[model samples]
Target: MRKKLPLGVSLFAMLLLLSSQAFAAPQSELWPTWDNSNESNSATFDHSQWQHLLDRYLTEEGQHTLFNYGAVSSQDKAVLEQYLTDLTSLDPRNYRQSEQFAYWVNLYNALTVKVILDEYPIKSITKLGGFLSFGPWDDKATTVAGQSLTLNDIEHRILRPIWNDSRIHYAVNCASLGCPNLAKTAFTAENTESLLDAAATQFTNSEKGASVDGNTLTLSSIYEWYGVDFGDNEQAILKQIDVYRDGKPLKGWSGKIQYDYDWSLNKP
Candidate 1:
């Protein structure tokens, strides 16, 4: 007799097919030419193995998951914190090109979650204070492979030019409901396409992001912070938003965006 199909066999089959086609070879396999010989990348991650690890840790529930950190459904965020600690202990030199890429992406995200958990009830991320104050984001003093790192360092130092992909903005969610929703999975060089697409879609859809009503154009403060990354000027960012509008009709759009960084630990 033939083996019976599972209850949701059809859906599972569809997903498996998609995953098979969608999943690309790990970064190490793809970019054998990359030469980061030293341990500039974190040791715990294997650029070759990190994609799956991130997706798992990101989706993992209970212990390292944030499903039950403050309560509702699970401890997914809690799980994330533990993983952050675990990642910090890993040897960066152990990972190659892609593994290091995935590790930094995961590190940035995990740190963001940690920030919100510490100040769960705050209205905005800015409340943590500024450069001198050690706001919630600043307080993120985790040891990655024995080195203390901050969110700023991760972005400004590691992830930025190393990958040299500005699209990274979408991947790193700020935890504001207005900001892109933290992806349910971690970002790896292999699955980067999916993550970047998700980030762009989320940023476009969020009200805090660029939206239009008739001839008026409204945009999120993100456009302001990394405007240079988007384009040479405001017009450059506006032009990008125009494409995402899906025929929303462009006109004399102009407005000032008030920045509201989300610090509410991306729970749930």
Candidate 2:
């Protein structure tokens, strides 16, 4: 004979399991269509409109880069819509790999901003979804080359699988306070490399990304959620972080590792 758990205890355990599963990191499955990029093409996509919007709304306060979402003028909103329209109008497969990378990153970021602006005054991006849903990540946000895409699809399926670069995590913003800062300038083929390095360096050095107190190390939930992307283990993850930390490599704070994140909207 086996002992059964009390009803209340069983229910609590079930809820805990469900919550953990809900927030688990998505796998990087390739969307094969996106893998088709021309290597020799020299064409460049113009991201000036997005750059203008970023320059106008993104402001840095201490360690955080917040967007002035409430300050966006109706005219500027129109400009944003036009920028997205222009981006989606073309086929990224026709461009070079560098151009495609920049295009996808810019589109992903602009769509996230538009989602927040569409539902302004919310406390967090997670509120955009139903009780069981995890934000609007799975909801169709836009279309490109006749294919519909969600934030999740763009990130996990397209960007992550295509590049297989952990730095991709630093480039995509989710409009949340705990996410990597949204760049003040738009991504372009010419500047994507430097931008990725800068973003990684800025975030890894910030307390929000990783901090040490006594013998404990506290890190952003990004590493917890997407551990496989970094290295799938504590030692490998620490090595990735050390590559970006400002000064000498992190040392001694190996006692306890904790991960946390804030879900508040990244807005001023």
The lDDT leader among the candidates is 2
Question: Candidate 1's error at 255, in angstroms?
Answer: 8.5
- Kindly report which residue stretches of model 1 are placed more than 4 angstroms away from their true locations once superposed: 1-69, 72-78, 129-134, 242-245, 248-268
Q: What is the per-residue lDDT of model 1 for residues 1-268, given as tens digits with 9 covering 90 to 100?
A: 9898877996789767754543221121122222254546444353323333345434433311222225412455546555766777775545666667667777776677567666666555555644334344435457655556667666655666567665677777555544555566666656777777766765675565665555455666566666666677666666776655545533234554344343344445
- For all predicted structures, in order, the TM-scores are 0.64, 0.93
Q: Please give the CA lDDT of all the candidate structures.
A: 0.56, 0.91
Give, for candidate 2, the lowest lDDT window spanning 10 residues. Answer: 246-255
Per-residue error (Å), model 2, residue 148: 0.9
Candidate 1 lDDT: 0.56
Which candidate number maximizes TM-score? 2
Q: How many residue pairs clash in each candidate?
A: 26, 0
